[model samples]
Target: MNGVVQNDAWREEYNTLKEQYTELKRLKEEVKKLEKSCFTSSQKQLKKLSTIKKQLSKGTSGQEVTAKEVTEVEESLKKIRETLPQPNNLFLRSIVGSINVTIPNSEDKLVYKERYENFKRNVTIVICILSLLAIWIRGYTRLPEFILQFVSAWFYLALTVREQILIRNGSKISTWWVLHHYFSIAIAGIFLIWPEGECYRNFQMQFLYFTLTISGIMYLQFIYQKGQLYKLRTLGRAHQMDFVQDAGMRSRSMGDLYFLVPFLLYTYVFQLANSYRLYNMYYMQECQTLWQVPILGVLFFIVALGNTWTLALVLVRKYNS
Candidate 1:
């Protein structure tokens, strides 16, 4: 008798999920027609998107969902996701990412989201660890700054390729984030051409420390994000790729922002310190008899300001929401 009752309850929930899916599919069509007015009707479209998100996030009510329903939900959502404005660094994706020497675009094939994210995390760990090691043990190798430049460029290229893959695979990291890697690559190139001198000796060791700090932070973030993604995968809402991992909770970008506050705050402080040192160098040049402004340092200062502002926005949105 208990088994029969449980079966009946599952059947009822299954029926409801099917109805919700159908309604979401219908809204998807409406969204397509209104795509031209999407900017104008931003609020309405946001609400509609939220509704679709909720439908997808619905979990098993202690009942086994059929494979057929699962496929339908996945297909329906992916189709809509394809319609989202593709945010990416066009030049990097179009030109740089396809350079024959980089990793092949295996990501073009439909891969499991969690598996793909894990791959990205692995790549991050491998590249960052290698770069940090090269910096720390530069004595034995007697490596030149150009060696670090080459390594930095190589890693940033990998980053560019990875961001392209993520964008194609429905990750929500913005085009700005993708472009950041490009700037990093460009900076590494600048570092390659920068002549070694007394000024560089003053800057080199500090920069190496900065590199280690950033790399360490990235590794920690990877561990946290990977665990979070695993939880989302277990919960069956891993399909909501955009909001998972970053947020400890589902459908809460604000929660992700809050969760990252500590990390982002550290980032802000480091960037601020870096920018201050750069500004001091630049000011000294102004007061000196020679053209001594640190061009790369000034550029880093500018980037630091932008990053700090971006973090502030994330925090403000988190609290307001």
Candidate 2:
């Protein structure tokens, strides 16, 4: 009798689960139908607007009526788009194959954004630690130096993908910030493949020191900038999606400016110095044949110039605002 009772209970639970599954399937179909309907309606609205535009161009009189109609159509179209799912950009579409990257829920988006920021902070710590190890080892054959480059390359690649996702979710990351990572990836790759010899030995310690210094500065910037962002968000001056890692200077105060500018300038100056050293090294009798020297010099110089210019623009914008 107990066995029979257990079998009946199991059957009832299975039936309940089956009913819930059926309801979920029906709800999914309804959502798909709603999406299709919205898209079709938007297409129709666009066609209607195009027709009106052509009619206006053809000199159909009633100019005020035409203008009013155009305004109404555009407003309606905007509303329609607001209701529709945002289409993914080419970069994101290529990787994720049409899956939406936009996190519609505010809390979920905040969690993802914060996670990315935390990841960068942790990676910065790792880079700093490895850089110090590389400096301590003090040799071209050291594993820490090579591992640091590899880690940097991987980190930047990950950053580029994450930033693209963040942008889809309404984060205002600039174009240069994304491109900067690509440049860093290339720089790191160059460092990795750079043959171990006199040329490598010449720059290895300097590179490690530079990495350590920059990582420290970056970690500091992350802390201060994150605090500034929180303050700005509280005061309604900054968006929640705005982050420390973003290239823009949205929430930056004069205090941050004073704190950040000199360090950043020094960082760029170091890059320029590195570029100059690489340039001089290229013409030297021992290093002339190495292809990585000139390419890296050019890359470093480009990044330095871009960064300086971007910083200048931000300062100007901040002052003006």
Candidate 3:
């Protein structure tokens, strides 16, 4: 009876051990399946993350990405990381950290710098031509306007070339010099194309229109240059000499004042010329019905005086200042 009892006890113990072993095997299988799924999910998440990182690095604007989309991607990556084994978790963490900083290519920077220099040079040439035209109209017309125009144009062109060389050598062209050059060219062009006589009156009107258009454009440019100068001066006052060293900034300030003087002169001349032509036409046609000759004369005189006074004041101030 005792032996039977002992055998029964052994059997019960073996059954208990068997049950525990079966449970442990089942748990191991489940853990293996979970690990496999985690690995697959992690791989997918890594690939998606890599793609997103590439897009970001390619200069994608923040405006194009939505908060919701970023959150979703981040959440997915987080879930994947949580399931990943310790070794892979470290790798994913490394990838996430590295994605934020981008390495710039020196070659691309060089290319952009070259393109900017080319643009500046072209602007300088246009300015030079405009200067020649202005000077020619101002009183150099006897030397065969075209020849004088050509020589003056070439002279400024040479100056621009020298300025460019100076710039290349690390010295900058003065803004005043550039403005002077461009204003002279523009004035020259206007004078060269000014209309005279009935035969060319219409042409003159057209040219006047063109000059007005150019004046508007130049006015805007002048304003921009002035703003730049103001900022540079402010910076200089702040002890930011680095701003002063910028060729464009230094040139723009002087250019602004230089251009402003000529611009005022050109405006006066344009108004005077247009008014005279209009009066002459009315007189010839006997259609002076609107304005009396005296009134027109007074208006013209006032405008001319005001313009001359303005120019004189400007010069005086410039010299004194």
Q: List clash counts for every candidate, in order.
A: 0, 0, 16
The window of 10 residues in a row where model 1 has the poorest summed lDDT is 100-109
What digit string (tens of lDDT, one per residue) describes model 3 on residues 18-99? 9999999999889768876876877777786666666766756344765467668877765454333433223233434323
| Candidate 1 clash pair list | none
Tens-place lDDT digits, model 2, residues 1-321: 455454788899999999999999999899878977887889888887887788788877445656777888787786555445667777677767887675657788789988999999999999999998888877445788779999998988888888888776667777888888889989999998998889888887788888998899999888877877777788898878776754226755655578778889999999998899999899887789999999999999999999999999988888888
The digit string of per-residue lDDT tens for model 1 on 1-321 reads 455454788899999999999999999889656753643455455565555555656753344545466567666655554544433456654765543222213354334445556665665566566667767776665364456567777777766675565556566665555656766777677766655555555566666766667766766766766567666667776655453335343324665545556875676577667657756665554323223235566556666677677667656665677
Q: How high is the lDDT of residue 55 in model 2?
A: 76
How high is the CA lDDT of each candidate model?
Answer: 0.59, 0.83, 0.49
Q: Could you tell me the C-alpha RMSD of candidate 1 in Å?
A: 16.5
Q: Arrange candidates by TM-score, descending.
A: 2, 1, 3
Instruction: State, as a TM-score between 0 and 1, how close model 3 is to the true structure.
Output: 0.27
- Displacement of residue 142 (Cα, Å) in model 2 is 2.0
Give the clash count for model 2.
Answer: 0
Using lDDT as the measure, which candidate wins?
A: 2
Predicted model with the maximum TM-score: 2
Q: What is the lDDT of candidate 1?
A: 0.59
